[model samples]
Target: MLELKEITKIIGDKIILRNFSLALAPGESVAVIGPNGAGKSTFFKLAAGLMQPTSGEILLNGEQIKKKTHLLKKRIGYLGHESFLYSALTPLENLRFYGKLYKVKNIEEKGMELLKAVGLHYFKDIPIRSFSRGMIQRLAIARVLLTEPDFLLLDEPHTGLDQEAVSLLNLLIKERQEKGIAILLISHDFEQVIQVCERVLILNKGRVVEDKSIDHQRGLMPFKNWYEAAVSGK
Candidate 1:
């Protein structure tokens, strides 16, 4: 489980996140949605331990995350909009490199299997420089999977994906949740969120203004409506 206790982040004179708190359990997937500058990405970075909150605690599996920083990294995987892949390296090589970094045993075999699962096996030997944005995203996902993380944090995961890629990603997300992985996905796609995430947290002005299940808020305006509201500072 992951827990955030009254997390508050301040940058200069602005408060990006204020007294934000939430808990995520195993076998659960959540979508963080809001308009631009809602601090959704900032929240992800905090959970992934890339940044610290000004006044709060983030705990993983009952342990204070900061105290077990190294162990926490092993249990959580994060992917942002950036591909984070070596452009000169083949897909397989990239996966292998990340697997090794994670200390995964039999990196080659595991990398191959992961690439195959993400539908990148055929292009395993092709350098990432030749891959499209969507293909590279798939490969990036594969790299994270190789670590067998207990939690996943993805920012703008569907940004450049096509319909087919979106379908595959949805399938994989369901599969991962079934495997007991807790996932936090930040995105602007409300329909996609409704399809996969059982719950959502809406951030605005660096604060979580609404936290509820999709079913609970079904009667409200559609996601696009909510997005416009947040971005436009409504």
Candidate 2:
């Protein structure tokens, strides 16, 4: 459903991504693991069309995304590190605003349903500025889901989430996968990555250095060991 071909991003004298390429099939989920400054977030931005690559191409559903950014916007959902919510807006109001932006059908109904899914229905009328970090993150998830996007790009989605909230996230991702939404995520939590992703890509110094499938039978420790080894250059 999404493909990045030889994508390169350079800023002044620094290269953020070097010929990075990846393909995510419909309903498939992939996780990106890397240390700080490894370009994971940059990859997410390029995939979401928030930034353009210095070279190469990004495609969605067989169309070049750079050439059809508007259409691409309609098909992808992105969750950055920040909640990006309006401090003065309540959960309901925030969803209502974004729902309209996405031209979602039954906006009110959808907005309410999403708030409920994220456990924010009770706080629907309360201003977001008073919310806890996890609460705001939950609301952000609701905001992203309002569009029912075909491709989901998440950067550090587990940040600020408690155990229950993380479980909720896992459940949501499983549901999206069942419905054929492609997911691309950047996460430091190996457990979450193992739970939701079939494949893992390790990025270092602006390039993908390791790409491998998760062997569920091997359990968590082995995967953790592998990731540690990869990142530590073992």
Candidate 3:
């Protein structure tokens, strides 16, 4: 559903990504783990069509992503460092606003459904400024899922979420994965990585240093050990 072909991005003189290539298929989830200067954020932006690559190209459904930003907004669900929500608006109001932008049918019903899924139905009318960090994160997730996006680009999605909230987010991710949504994740939580992703790639210095398919039987320890070693240069 998504492809990044030999992509590279340069900002001023610093190179952020180098010859990065990836293809995501329906129902597959991939995790990217790397150190601070590893360009994971750049990779996510490029894939989401939020940033243009200095070289190479990104494609979605066989079309150049840059040319179809409207399609990108509809097909991609992105949760990034920014919440992209209104602090003064109630959760329902925020959802309704975005739902209208996405042109989702039955906006009110869909807003309530996703709010309930995120355990924020009771706070549906509460203004976002009064919420806690975890509450805001949950509402952000609800906003992302409201459109039933085809591909989810989640960057540290568990941020500020409590244990229960984390589990709830995983449950939602798993459900969507089952329904054939391709997922691309950048995260550090071992359990979240193991539970939802089928493949993990270790990126560093703008390149893929290690890429391995998850072996569910081996458990998180083995993969954790591998990740530690690969990026630690062990």
Candidate 4:
């Protein structure tokens, strides 16, 4: 459902992404892992139509993303590292607002469902300013799901969450995958990556250094193992 052909991005004199290509089919979950400053965010921005690539092309659903930018926005859900919620707005109010923006049918019903899904139902009446970081993140997640998009882009989704929250997110990921949502996860949590992603792509210096599939029975390996292997060219 998503494809990139030799995508490259340059800022001033520095090239962030160079000749990077990736394709994700519907219903597949891929994890994108890399060291800091490896251009992972740049790649996601290019795919999400937030930033244009200096070279190459990005396609979503067989059409050029640049040409169908507005249409594609409706089909993508992006959860950034920070929870972009209005501090003064209650969780219900926030979801209701975004639901209207997305033109979601039965806005109130869907809002309630989403709030419940993210474990924010009881806090629906509390303003986000009074919420903990984890609560805000749950609201952000609810807003993302309010759109029911086909593709999801997550950047450090586990930030500021405890083990219980992380476990909930894992269940949520599995649920989304069952619904055929294509996920591109960028996270520093190697354990989450190892457990949730079927395919793993490692980035280094603007290029993909490793791309491999984990068999269904397999799980995430230690980050040190991968990092050392990368350095030693194993």
lDDT of 1 by residue, 132-204 (tens): 8889989888887888999988887888999999898889888999999998988777777888888888888
**Please, what is the TM-score per model?**
0.92, 0.96, 0.96, 0.94
Query: Which residue runs does candidate 2 get wrong by more than 4 Å?
Result: none
RMSD of each: 2.2, 1.2, 1.3, 1.6
What digit string (tens of lDDT, one per residue) describes model 3 on residues 155-197? 9998778988888889999999999999999998877888889
TM-score of 1: 0.92
Candidate 3 overall lDDT versus native: 0.89
Q: What is the lDDT of residue 12 in candidate 3?
A: 87
Off by over 4 Å in 4: 215-223, 231-234
Candidate 1: segments with Cα more than 4 A from true spot = 216-234
Candidate 2 on 173-226: residue-level lDDT in tens? 899989999888899888889899999999999988899988878889998888
Error of 3 at 96 (Å): 0.8
